[model samples]
Target chain A: MEGLWALISDDLPALQIAVPLLAATLCVLIRRPTAAWAVAMVVAWSSFANAGVLLHRVLTTGTISYVEGGWPVPWGIELRIDLLNALVLLVVTGICAIVLLAAPRSIDAEIPRDKQYLFYAVYLLCMTGLAGMTVTGDAFNIFVFLEISSLSSYALVSQGRTPRALTAAIQYLVMGTIGGTFILLGIGMLYMVTGTLNIVDLANQLALVGPNRTVMVAAACIAMGVGIKLAVFPLHIWLPNAYTYAPAIVTAFIAATSTKVAYYVLVRFAFSIFRINQTFDGAHSSAIAMMLGIAAMFAGSLVAIYQDDVKRMLAYSSVAQIGYMILGLSFANEYGLTGGLVHLFNHAIMKCGLFLVLACVLLRMGSTRLSAFAGLGRRMPLTFAAFVLGGLSLVGVPLTVGFVSKWYLVLGALEAGLWPVAVLILLSSILALVYIWRVVEVGYFKAPPEGADAITEAPFSMLLPTWILIGSTLVFGVWTSLSVGVASAAARMLIGGGS
Target chain B: MIEWGLYNYWVVIFLMMTGLYVVIARGNLIKKIIGLNIFQVSVIMFYVSMGKVRGGTAPIEAAGFEVYSNPLPHVLMLTAIVVGVATSALALALVVRIKETYGTIEEDEIRRIEADEDAS
Candidate 1:
């Protein structure tokens, strides 16, 4: 057993990517929905376990570097996982695994059975891309993985029942392609100047080069490119429609993982690779990020308040949640960066749980409209209870993960001597309250339409996963050692690397 | 004095902007995709041009040849071209489905139809 464990541990990085990718191909070949789902489920759980092991290894031994094909680091592609990506890897894979546990039931309702196998296959491929992006230390390899994930998501989004899904997918495709191209161009420019595609090497070379116009341009291009993917306020137009019209499981999975991964990339580019202050003329970039994040917080929350569709409201809320993460990043201090990174994990758990609640509602009622949620609190007690708990977390009430993340963010803001930013963070939590309360009122206070009594709770299969994530909101909220502890370590590493 | 040797970059910028403009201005899905293609091609051209040396042949082993154009960018761009092609193919496929379902591939028309559906 020890020998077997040793063998698996040696190839963890390669296995993280290859398992899903190869399984995705197997899913396509299987061509049976149940079989494909089983394959995807097994792969998701294994990847989750693999991510857990990788994070453990990183925490114990520090960064793990794997050189592909036994080639040298500067020339061959490398997979590097420091604390930052190890934390992100856990979030991505953990969310994927939990969401997949609830997927089969939700997927059955939204997608035609004939195409369900294709759905699972594409889902695994998307997972492959996201995991690859997290693990790769090569500059060009990030682009490759970004495209893999983007293309698969486009395909997944278009699988929705409504025709609007197609439009959403196309818009996302165009914007996403533009974003990918910008990244490609930036990588090309960096290669032109530094002649290396290794991220660490590029960072070292960039520091030595010291503020060339080409490097500045490269940084700007990569920032904007990742900004598009990150959906940082102005670039978030494609998000709402895509989420609103997508299949429930797709919306949950992507909402939980994709933007978080994109934000990880943004963190990497800003802190790890370009060293934000040095690249952007000192503190100007932070001001820009702060402004955008502030705008996103208010604008996203205000927009969410008016959305009649519950899924659309949550999607807009995702925009605002992304703001909190970015706001954490803008502070660039250890506490602030920890807030951002911890929010990445906290938000993934809560938001995914909330979406899973929607999936349960959709499974039973055929809709996620506000009107459909009337008296759902009485009928689907477990699911709506999950929603309320998740909503409380979103509102940053004490004893919830949301509160944990927000506390750190506020602490970070105060530490940075930006008391106004702290006040604004509190104010935005009120906005979150207004939107979440809107749903609560609809779910609890409003009367069910006539003859709505037959509505039942979501299946155990679905509710188990929903509550697992919802339960973790409280679990991690009280036990900050796992989320906040790892996050601060990652934040310190980033700050140390940057300086 | 302007460096005439840097003419390739000028072409790249022009093509890139033109492609971006078309992608933004065109309402037709197919045209938008074509614009995206143009935009991608500009980047590809930029990378390919960067790899070229002043007096280099294709990267190959020969007794007399000393200088060879860098093959890395060319190889990288090969992967990029494949990605670009995949993107276009997927975009075109989505366009086909949109046309079939919405009965029009024009962005305005699709929006109008969706807005009508939402109202009812």
Candidate 2:
């Protein structure tokens, strides 16, 4: 038993990725949807446990690296875990478990009867892909896992009942393929120059090769590819429809985790693998990131204001939130990266909470239109209260996780002496307030339609998960040590200790 | 001779640009997927080309084989080709669904249908 425990602990990172994949296959074999969900639940919770154990190990010890097949570096794939990746793994798997707990009813409502098991199967695959992408230290391995996630995400999005879901899935496929191809091209270019694909080795070798035209082009291709995947600013055309059209659980899970993982890849590339400070190309790339980050913050918020569908509005808001994250990274400073990394955690909580509440509202009332939200505060008090709090967090009100992330972002902007960017960050939060308030006003102050007066609360299962996320927003808001401390460590490790 | 050697890159650039143009310019869903396929194929070709070291032969291990082609990019592109195939299949399935729902697979027609839905 002691030996078995040692094996599990030593192999936790690989198990965190592998267990979900194995469970995914098992889910496909299971014909009953409920049974599939049970398998996924066991798998998801075990992954969450693995992430916890891995985080504890990384925190207690140091960075952990596992090479596949006992092959040394440069000859085999390595799964490396540091503070940043461990935290991201925790967030991805933790939220995935919570979302899966809330999924059975939502899946029942949103998907056809026979296809429900397949949904769980695909969900596990998506989860495995996401966790795999987060843990792998190989550059090309990122692409493989990225496609694994992207392909499953396309199928997951298409499982929605609305026909528009199909279009949204296709749209994402086109954009995602282009993005993945660009990333592959970038990796290929890097391999051509450096003759290595392990990220750490690539970074060391790049120090010798220095910046050339091919390196510059490779950098551009990778940034563009990851930018699209993260849906940073101008490349976010596909996100809104995909989020708006996918099933509520799908939207919540993917929205909370996938883009965060993609952003992790972007940050990993820019700061760690490429070591942006060491090359001239890094400066140009950071400039573009800053420009697009600012653009996305303004454009996404402004477009969100006019959207009548709450789901669509929240989707746009996510784009703006992504902008904030990218803006944090653009600064290339410790505080800036901290802000970015913490926001990745905080935004996942708030948005997952917010979207889960939206799902509750959708489950109660058939639609998610702004008009359908009328008097929901009185009718569905628990769910709307969660929404209001989540919305407050989204607007970066004090004492919410959103505020902690934004405060660091503003401080970073100020420290960088970009006062205008600081002001714009504040201004975008106000824009967030306006859009969030639109729903709050319509929900709380307005009257329900005549026949809808008898609407009640969301089910206990859904409400439980929604509140768990909402409660975290408040808990982590007050105690900054968990999110902020980990984030600062991650930031220092990423920027202060890079190749 | 330098220009002759570098023309390979120029041809790659040309194919890539043409594929990207078709993807962006075309309105038909099927055409867009086809264009996307073209774009991906260009990338695959580029990867294959990058693996071809000038004096390298097939990477079979024998006593005298000193110059072997970089097998990594070729292996990477094989994975990429599978990804490309999966994406195209998913895209085509989505197109079929789009046709069923909107009665047309043209981008403009889908937009018109959605806009009409929005108006009412």
Candidate 3:
């Protein structure tokens, strides 16, 4: 019985991916849209519980590596879970459940009734792909699941009524294709240099080879490829449009989960897939990261201030937020990694609440224009209140989730003696405050748009999840232990340091 | 042996850059898709080139065969082709939708429309 339990625990990682995937296919057959949504919600929460328990198990223990059918490394596929993936897995599932719970009423207003059932099904498949990408150790498995998620996301984004959404989806498809292709090329390079599919085996073999030309090329390709996916600075051309034109729920889900998962993959690749000592010596490494982080921070915030649309503004802010995460990694130290990881978790809560609130506003006002939000605080007080809190978090205001991440990041930058970066971070937060306050001012102070009376609150279903996450920003802000605790350990684990 | 050290990689790099340049610089929608196709095919060539071992035959069940071209990159390129094709098909389908909506297939035209819409 004990042995069987261990075997079952070993299978948990794969099941977490496979269960939702199988349910998604079954959901298509359930003709009733309500039933499909019910099934998707249950699956999301179940995955969340599974991920939660798995995270707890790993936190208590250490890394868990389960080879397919009990095969050892270098011979079979592996599902590897350390603190890093476990944390991301929980965030993915948790966000998915919250978004799905709030999806119905939002969809009723924005999406036509006929498309509702299929929407939930596609959402589940996209969630499965994200979970699979997080949980797997095989490089090729990443590509396969990446295509699954990308295809579904295109469908979801283009589901928007605006014809411009089609163009946005096309651009994302084009850029995502190139990104995926470059990753394939990089993985092929690694395979040529080291004849193993298992990540641990590849790492061990790579250490023996050191940094050769092929390995360098692979590193370059992988970095560039994933930089595009995570929407890192200059490579982030596709994100604002995709997020802006996408369906509200789609934006909410992708905002909270998609790019963060890519960041997790980047960490896994940088830390585990290719060990540190071998990687840190790359020429132009620090320069590229620092250059791009500064660019993204300054450019993303400045551009965000010019946006009339709330969703696009938040998307630019995301680019800047990712800059902070990358800046943290540029330090390549324990504290640096901790700051990045903590920010990843904090940004998820803050951004998700912000997007969901935008969804709420869109439901009532039929647009996310800055002008339309004027005096919104009076009409839909709770929804706008959530935005203010979330915005405050985005601007790194004291006692919010964003403040915690920035504080730790500042400490980390100081530890690294990159005082300039510390200054840039502070400056960017002020820039963020400028954009965020622009929205807050319009929402609270400006007079309501003409013919804008009879506006009301987002339905209970929608507001419920929005407030839940908004409340979490406050909860996590004060506690610090949930994000900072996991992030510190996860960061240490990421940089191959003592956990 | 000299051929192995020289032209094998140069050709691959040249072709890859050519493809990438087209994707970045071209304005026509179909041309851009064609450029993407070229970009993908060039990468496949790079992988195939890397997999080649001098004087090696295909890996087949045989006796006393000491050398074989690496089959792994070849295998990966197959999947890459499938993904590439899927992307192309979806992209073209979207272009069709764009043509329907805006009645144009030119990248610059599409941009002008989007800009004009945003300005309004």
- For each candidate, what TM-score against the reference? 0.99, 0.98, 0.94
Give the true-contact fraction for every prediction, in order: 0.86, 0.83, 0.57
Docking class of 2: high
A384-483 in candidate 1: lDDT tens per residue? 9999999999999999999999999999999999999999999999999999999999889988899888888899999999999999999999999989
Q: What is the per-residue lDDT of model 3 for residues A1-499, given as tens digits with 9 covering 90 to 100?
A: 8997787666789888788898888888886689999999889998898898899888888888877777776667788888888999999999999999789888888688877888988999899889989988888778777877887888788878799899889888878878877887788789878977677778878888988888888988988988988999999999999999999999999988989988887887777777552454732675688689789999999999999898899999999999988887777778888888888898998999999999999999999989889999999999999999999999998889999989988888898898988998999999999999999999889999788789998899999999999999999999987688988988776666321
lDDT (0 to 1) per candidate: 0.93, 0.90, 0.86
Model 2: DockQ vs. true structure = 0.82
The collision pairs in model 3 are: none
State the displacement of the C-alpha of residue A216, model 2, in Å, after optimal TM-score superposition.
0.7
Question: Cα lDDT for residue A440, model 3?
Answer: 94
TM (B chain), model 1: 0.95
TM-score of chain A of 3: 0.96
- After TM-score superposition, the amount by which residue B12's alpha carbon in candidate 1 deviates from its true location, in angstroms, is 0.9
Q: TM-score winner between 1 and 2, please give it.
A: 1
Arranged by DockQ with the best first, the candidates are 1, 2, 3
TM-score of 1: 0.99
- When just chain B is superposed on the true chain B, each candidate scores a TM-score of 0.95, 0.91, 0.89
Each model's iRMS = 0.5, 0.9, 1.3
Give the residue spans of candidate 1 off by over 4 A: A1-3, A278-280
Q: Tens digits of per-residue lDDT for model 2 on B1-120?
A: 355655666777888888899999999988898889889988888888888888899899999879999887888788888988888888888888888888999989898888888789
Q: Write the per-residue lDDT of candidate 3 for residues B6-110, one digit (tens) a residue.
A: 576688778778878888898888888888888888888878887888889898959989899888778777877887887788788888888999999888898
